[model samples]
Target: MGDGLRLALTTYSVNPRGGVVHTLELAEALQAAGVLVTVVALSDQGKGFFREVGVPVRLIDAPAPAPTLEERVFQSIATLTEYLGEIGDQFDIVHSQDCISARAAARIRDAGTSYRVIRTVHHVDDFTTQALMDCQRNAILEPDDVLVVSKLWQDLLLKDYGVHAGIVTNGIRAERFSAGISELRRKELRQKLGVDDRFVYLTVGGIEPRKGTAYLVEALARLKATHPNPPMLAIIGGHSFQDYRAYRESVLDSLEPSGLELGKDVVLLGTVSDAELPEWFSAADGFAFPSMKEGWGLVVLEAMAAGLPVVTSDIDVFHEFLTDEDDALMTNAGDAASLAQGLARLVDDEETRRRLAQHGPTVAARYPWSATAEQHLEVYRRALNAR
Candidate 1:
């Protein structure tokens, strides 16, 4: 392995979305660890965030004005080829996130450059037939080291797509998520949210179909019916429904007739700034995330780090980091009754919640960004050796 790796990280967009945040956090951590890192993005939304964190960012041409159906295919190939041809020689390793950048990185590797190509699969769905067609078509020609965030994703890549990938779980910055907030700040946050002394159930993620927000709402409704002192559920993060708008609308419509007060019982605060997020986690009594599909549930670790008990889905990926009836309470994904039961256990039993909260931070400490970056450094070395 070289003395210090010069890494070129590529992604479609550097927006403040979950995947973008993962890329930025990893890049910043790697740079702090003395690795020379350059972030290359197709869009500029997250450029400021990266620069503010002291990471060098390069934004490619303005995404070529959102292409139509016929133009989309040709434009994708052209844009990727153009970007790689222009900047492929500047680094020792090209680490790509998401499918588009993966294909681009593969193309650069195929060009016979000295730079080694590496790709990280943030989500298993990225390897689906319709999702990563370009990568599938060119993967054989453009061989590169693949990295996946979860064992579930790694297995999907190997079993479904026959692609070998190294596993590097996503991590959070523990210091930033620590429970050292002043009492004044906590009180201010609670006052701002109108959350008095009642227990709060918090879930943070985009409001999308895959995120299972509707399931969360149904569970909250169920909890209200059964429990005398039901905690309020606060959902953070905003999303575009687009074609899925009908489902979101239907869920809202159903909630209206369910006899549950919106602000009183359930509140959807949409997107929140990163600074405001920790206080939300700190104020919450327990965390509930019953997402049906996720590449990595980084929020679960964040909640745990904030000293909040977690109630999450019993999926293979989630189980890889959290155990059933241990650090987190696992419930059936997309099942409102199961989710409600899981939340009820945490709500009704204060001692159990306290016990889980006490143990949660210890488990979360194992997944700091430094460890995750070290793992990626190893992968970069392997890619460079292969080259």
Candidate 2:
């Protein structure tokens, strides 16, 4: 832990998206470990991060939203590159959490800055457009060192890109979520969300392609038919750099045919406050996350920390942390029928739910931000020595 070690951490946005959350948490943890960390992000219309940060922050003005994803990527890279160029020489390491930021870090490095560029590939995307594809490719290939959260992603990188990346899984603040909420506070949250007597299945990360929102809807529809009392599904936090209006429209259209109402049966509480997030987790009966892919499912760990029984996708990233019917009920990715069955089991089987809820905190306790920070320090030190 060098007191003189200064690092610049970059992310695409200041929103509560998984990557942004990772950047903020890591920056704070690193700062606590005696490293001078400055969190830099592309701000939309000059807005700051979702919550107050303990570490220093630099927000580059994005000013306005770009019409398309490709244009946004270009703008993010240009702005971050320009900003980093002005101050890049001051830091020993410039680490980026997303592709857009990674591209910018790569650009500044190409301009001959001595700062080491470290990129974390949370997950690979399947992009149809060549520009977006190339952006992803270059972001992965150009960085001095690439990191992934799980061995699943590390293996994927080696297989797909011929790149070997170090593995650093995510960590959680278990007690923040696991601490018992007062009954009054719990009632307040439930009342606020209009949840009364119904089992609430909560999923963060709003309607999007990767979140498997449509499939979750279909599962809810199926669960409604089989179960005596169908639980309400509450969705939270969908803010992202990419537009998902078309995907959102499709999810909305399916709601009518699935015999589900928008506000009552399925509540779309988009991007709730950071204070309210843990409260929502406390109020919900179960957590449902059927994402098709993730660098590592950070929310699943958060939900586990909150002592909520989880039903998530049987994806490789999840497999690294969860065991079927132990800490979480695993469902086949992209399969409505399988998800429905898994959800039904959680509803019907009290013993399994109790067991999962009991074990979840134990599982979540294994990952503390302190430990994650130590692992990252190792990576930073290695890169610095090599430099």
Candidate 3:
């Protein structure tokens, strides 16, 4: 405990999704606390996710590309496992953030004589494909100690696979996002994005079944009845390592409706740079997240930190950190009417919006990266000592 914990983190992608973001921040925080840290990921892209970052990303590029997700999954595991030869033996705690990395970590641990493997199940996916399902099962069960972002995910692990995962909730960079932008910066960002005096209802997750992209489109369309001058919906996300490009396009085909029109009212800004993300959050009037499922809705915390009034899905994972009326407005994910009403409440009521915004920064401030790193260290120490 005096010197440091030798921690090596493995994430599924060298991309800017919530899990990868968590891995980067946690590694840096631990490094600051005097721990020796290394990060590894399976790479499909040539560029690293961060521009100017402290921790160096070690990307294990696959030898040959695959046509489907199943093949990609196998290739990622094989590539990372083979590459693990160089870095796997140097750490006391080898933690994985996703399934592919978990499989790779297990392979490394089984082959090598050193290091303990722990898997952080960001969220449990009910995958239809057999290969993907087996990958998830092996990833969860093979690890020594499992970690999850929310109790809901932990409960899911227990019910479905009978594995109990430790709950180390996801953190937000509150100081990074919680700070208000200058009026000049705000005006510049608004003009640059071509978003006029419109009240922007922002959603950040890319199009997917779990993300409920279709449901939010319907809800935004339904909001037209109550909020006549409806907010233009801005979705800012890209496809992750998952092969969801086809899924995204299929969901987009369903977007043309009464109130929501693509290229006009509904703007799809596919993934903003990390440096510019806070500004995008600052420019928004409201944050809308109608996800069918979530581990802990990291974007919701980020929106709250930025002091935006939130209208998110009323899932159990969200309920873990956020209150019904106190943190943000919550709506049933399946019901478009309920979701519409939630967004309408935020749009119509100025006082309620102010209430959520004012209290949100305070809530976000409580879960900094330091706190998250501390929880991770506690678990790491327990694992090391037990070994």
State the lDDT of candidate 3 residue by residue for 1-387, as single tens digits.
Answer: 316677788887766888888899888888887788888877665656554558766876655667887888898888888888677877788899999888888888888648999999988777779889988899999999999988888888899999989999688888788777888898887765567777888888778878888788788788765665876788888756667777787777777646557876788788788888888889889999989888788888899999999988888888888899998888997888899888888888999999999988988887898888888888888898888
Which residue pairs clash within candidate 3?
none
In model 2, how large is the Cα lDDT of residue 341? 93
Instruction: List residue ranges in candidate 2 displaced over 4 A.
Output: none
Model 1 pairs whose backbones collide: none
TM-score result, candidate 1: 0.89
Task: Give model 3's TM-score versus the native structure.
Answer: 0.95
Identify the candidate with maximal lDDT.
2
Lowest summed-lDDT stretch of 10 residues in model 2? Answer: 63-72
Lowest lDDT 10-mer window, candidate 1?
44-53
- Local accuracy of candidate 1 as per-residue lDDT tens digits, 1-387: 235788988766644566777888999889988899998877533234422556898876534544342244345546766888887888898887766676767776677767877777776442334534554435422547777788888888788678888899788987778855788887886676677887788888756677788888888888888777777888887632113566667777777677677777777777777687888898778898998888888888889989999999887889888888889899999899999899899988888898888888898899889888888877777676776
Q: After superposition, how far is residue 60 of candidate 3 from its true place, in Å?
A: 2.0
Highest TM-score scorer: 2
Task: List pairs with backbone clashes in candidate 2.
Answer: 122-295
In model 1, state the lDDT of residue 214.
Answer: 85
* TM-score, cand. 2: 0.98
Report the Cα lDDT for residue 274, model 1.
69
lDDT of 1 at 32: 81
> What's the ranking of the predictions by TM-score, best on top?
2, 3, 1
